[model samples]
Target chain A: MKKFEHEVIFCIVNAGFSDAVMDAAREFGARGGTVIRARGTANMEAEKLFGITVQPEKELVMILVKSAIKEDILHALYRAVGLNTPGQGIAFSMPVDQVVGLSEAPIEPKAEEQAE
Target chain B: MSEAITKKEKTPIRARAARAPRGSKRIEQVTAPHKLKLLFTIVNRQKAELYADLLQAYDVNMQMFLSAQGTASTEMLQYLGLGDDEKVVIASIIREDLAADALHMLEEKFRTIKNGKGIAYTVPMSGTIGVAVYQFLCNHRGDRV
Candidate 1:
């Protein structure tokens, strides 16, 4: 199997804001994402330690994209709902070793030229 | 809870003492190297709990299970044996050494089980912002904060 350099973007925001997250990501060229419903277990102790109030319910949006555009997508996400924003979301990326099921490869320059 | 209590009662005092050090040693082994990977499992919603339980048994607890919808068309979904568009996405922070075992367990389940017809993958976490946060994410229960 060939290794396709990819990154998984995890954006955790206040509940019910997954659409906003996806929207921001799409603007920055992300094809699609998976939204997961999660609950934040950060208690008062965590709040005091981090000096931030963590929302109890969180929506985690996971986006798999080409490694090349990972930074662009993350920056777009941060601007939309980052820690300074009302959603108070935290976004991070990790290196994915492999990927499958994506309908199109985001990194193929040939595909883009053919489309044009 | 009852099962745990009963098991505790059944264990001999010396055996329990012997097990305690091994458990602590395992924690030390996981934390000493300080490498982390994120395990992502996409499975049918019904099998999500079972997947989580399997990971927990491997000491890969502290998972985030998210409900998601697959974008595959109906025909594609049926071909993949997915009953519906609904899916469960589980992400757990695990030590690097245990990631292979975790992925293997998930893969076995995916192949043998009817509802486990999804995918499992891992991502390397380059770094965590703070030591306290890293401990909170990776440490097992009662491993000392």
Candidate 2:
């Protein structure tokens, strides 16, 4: 029942641009991400309202990172593929209360033992 | 005075609905009382189909699959016997009440099976446009919606 304070960042961009997202995230210390292929369901009216073209084929990049660096990674992603750019990707983060599959950290000697 | 105020309030709603186009009217009829949660599962690419079949038995269908790679270091991945970083991430929208059971089932599958070593989680959806759209995403094609 250990709790790992993490955030899952979702960056939805045009198809085939997930590599850009992963590269941007890695620069900011993000471990890795998963990309899911999705079709954008936004109608023509939504496109006009948002002032951006909505590509039907979309790539959703889901990155799991520590809460502390979530903002940095998100900002980095935005710069790489924000609405202003052709990618027109929108990024958001959600709280993840727990996680698994991560390798256990190597045990470190206690401070007293290290000083001995 | 109260009757008059009530009449005034009722007229605008009728007027608005009348003003709306045909599509808007269809949307109004399909609104639901509950919201949906999105469940995401990341696992080895080879195991994606297996998990999809497992989730189907729980009445959770309409899954979307995507290919991805893990960012873990090569050494760590080697330690875990994960040959390559290739992975498949699956997404599905389900009712809030079934989220707990779905997650539990995923966890149990991971524990009981050899290739179930992966991570699964859920994200709460604030709202959906209309019940029709929600039903479409939830893969519920019944007439009850």
Candidate 3:
């Protein structure tokens, strides 16, 4: 099996700011991303600790990108929607072992491909 | 109740082990420092429920999803839809072994189902908050921990 050196990056920001996260990520080499509706549970004390207003409504943008360009994308995301900014977004990445269903040549050939 | 105790006493060895005290309920799932993975499956909105239901058969206990506007290239989007390409992203935390099987099932479905092409991948989780949380997320339900 062909192993994919990919990173799944998640960016959580206040609602309506996912476009910024996706735009910043696209600045690097990210082809596309998925946005999930979420809500943050930051209270007044949390706001005091973080020194940023916490919007309860949150949007999580998940982008799958090659490991080679992970850093660039994250850095861009930070500048674009970091906590200091109104977006108050945080970004992190996780390692991905397998990728499927992309038009790119399937890692394990299907029976038809194998026959061919 | 006496009946409850009777049932407990009559429980099989494995079931008894499941209810065993001192945090030994998940003998198999928690045997090693096994970290679960988050399986992300993005598919067309129409088939989200079908895929989510299929995932449940694979011992996936916890799963959630929300509509996502895919950022596919314009040409690809046009091919997939007239203009709107609504997608659903399903996030499920599963044990590594089950995660692999779920990915394989998804691959097969994408190949066979019409208009069901999508992407699925796994991201290893670093830590879980509690043993019970871990058990529930990994589908080790009803076991005393």
Candidate 4:
């Protein structure tokens, strides 16, 4: 059965590379994306924490892709942007329940196996 | 000199009904504090800048804009904390027609329908203070003299 769903791909990465990231997304089946500057959080412990400055240089990218093409797009991004590599960035997707405007076709999900 | 105390204000006189509704007793009239206010919100900080730019390009006047973290998920079932991603909120009080135009511009430019980059929503306000402030906001884009 076909179902309607949304794919949300967003991540924060090193700054000054928004152009590159957008280019990669277009190559990965995304029509367009937006980038914003941001700062990473401080997660270090208090006592052991030395005065190392966490880089405030960060860019956030969000791309909406078809659910069927999500995996392909993610893999393409990972390969192109060194996402899985150190200091490259982090990216993930969650199902968007409802939206207006950029709605798209639904995809069929695999059938579950019945226990005998 | 002691000012004379005015007699308790008499009940205001009702105006003669020029055009009465046919038979029906119900009266429909727009009330005071009916000005429309719009709150445009976006979570993606990047899209925020673009939106602001688009508004500027369109010469849309903005009354006020505020930036802050989103608190929508604070009471969610999961303790899912709010991420460090900051949200930019733009608020403007405009005439109803202008608000509609602003919404159209947002849809045309931002494409909020698409996935995660950002989403924009608007809410209406009932009223505002000061004619001077109102005039200033209405002409904020510098397009209107």
Candidate 5:
């Protein structure tokens, strides 16, 4: 079996909160992610059990991160958008077999870093 | 700036590894051992429809697009010609082997089309809900489905 080096972390949150998801992830070394517009289908019973109105307008954020930082990014995402928050997001990850087109080029130094 | 453009120009070389689909070869030969893989092709909003159309030729039956925002830094996004920052995530159900051909096609389009650069990766799917649904998702153009 081939070992995987990257994982695509999927976070589904209430619409308009995708930016919040990315902000949380960026702090933890995630380069970025893509958002897929989606809708929530939780039955009323589940929504009532969770004590939150389920927002049908949802945003599925797909962030491809190195496996080493997967846990941190997931945790960051949970804190930022988990069910307790208005976003009421759920997050999970899947292993990636192969990737092409994106690369790990060096990010340009920010102003402070460049000054140093 | 020129260096960035050069890297973008050379991006196709990386995808050359996926063998171009040969007409003479039978589809069954490449698809026999493989199962369905989720092909996540993220591209600019403008090019999503074209990709979706091209993928169907390679046995991809289901393709869903999600409006997205790219997280690349400002400079990087500028270099990739994604000034608007709008993106589309095309999630397609493609067989493991056929994905290679689709990926090759994506690379070609990326090189030729202005601001057509995109990222493509696959995650292996473990199981499907039903055989009928699976067959439909992997529709082989009415040939031996």
Candidate 6:
């Protein structure tokens, strides 16, 4: 039998949208995600373009899941957050060469005593 | 509530300093004849933004980033059991002085310190393509036009 492969998706978004993005990710099939604060570098141009203040405040979220579910999770993020929209966010997945803790033996059910 | 208000009012100077424009000379100052490689990571997959932020602090005109998967020791792999994850590598040219500050920030902020979480590092840049490109990278963000 061929061994199964696992993939993980990592994403970083403006901090303001972290919750919404992560929530949608979990809804799709992601077990969980880690969120971290970050700052944006290119956004400095916003000050020149629009006189409005732009905060580089950013949040990064990483999710690990089976490669089979990559498309579903990506779509879920697109629909929920709309990466096309400014500050909405982006998502992508990479193949995992080696995985640990993913292989576990199945557990047997306890025998039941039936009285006729 | 009163205590919370007092804490908010007493915000540290460093927090306030972080909000201001990083030195406008970051671009020019960082590139002005320096021998340092601006090492960065794209494991989080936010290149453009991260680069932009760096430019605000240093004058890194030219940079190259490579996609890489995060790798861990077999023991760490088994202990943490990160199923399938990879780390990305981003390397750029920067001045020696700017490289030190960048490394400092990376150590204090990006790396796993008190929390023991994510991690990254930087190395000194040794060689380069040409002087013109080197100057351009350092001169882009100089306060003077």
Candidate 1 residue runs with Cα over 4 Å from true position: A1-4, A41-54, A105-116, B1-38, B46-83, B91-119, B125-145
How high is the CA lDDT of each candidate model? Answer: 0.76, 0.78, 0.83, 0.55, 0.83, 0.56
Q: Candidate 2: global Cα-lDDT? A: 0.78
Model 5: lDDT to the true structure: 0.83
Pairs with steric clashes in candidate 5: none
Q: How far off is residue A29 in model 2, in Å?
A: 4.4
lDDT of 6 by residue, B6-103 (tens): 88877875565666557655334554344555444334444334543654566666666554443332336657775444443455556666766665
Which lDDT tens digits does candidate 4 get at residues B1-145? 2333222222221222434554545454533432554534354555565667666543346635555443222235335654534666554445554555666666665554343344544444456778767655555433554
For DockQ, the strongest prediction is 3
TM-score of chain B taken alone, every candidate: 0.65, 0.67, 0.70, 0.50, 0.68, 0.51
lDDT of 3 by residue, A1-116 (tens): 64559988999999999888987887786877888888789689978998966569998888988889999999999999998888999999888997887665423534586898
Error of 1 at A12 (Å): 1.1
lDDT string, candidate 3, B52-112, tens digits: 9999998788898878877654566578667556899888888888877788999999999
DockQ of each: 0.23, 0.27, 0.51, 0.04, 0.47, 0.02
Checking candidate 2 for backbone clashes, the offending pairs are none
Clashing pairs in 1: none
The CAPRI classification for model 6 reads as: incorrect
Whole-model lDDT, model 4: 0.55
What's model 6's overall lDDT?
0.56
Query: Across residues A1-116, which tens digit of lDDT does each residue of candidate 6 receive?
Result: 53436666767676667667766766655554545566766665867898755557876665666778788888877776665655557778655433322324432332352332
Name the top TM-score candidate.
5
Candidate 1 lDDT, tens digit per residue, B19-69? Answer: 778668644556454588878888778889988998886667489977886
Q: How close is candidate 3 to the true structure, as a TM-score?
A: 0.69
lDDT of 2 by residue, B14-95 (tens): 9877888778866679766555777888888889999888877655757888787665534566797865677888887777
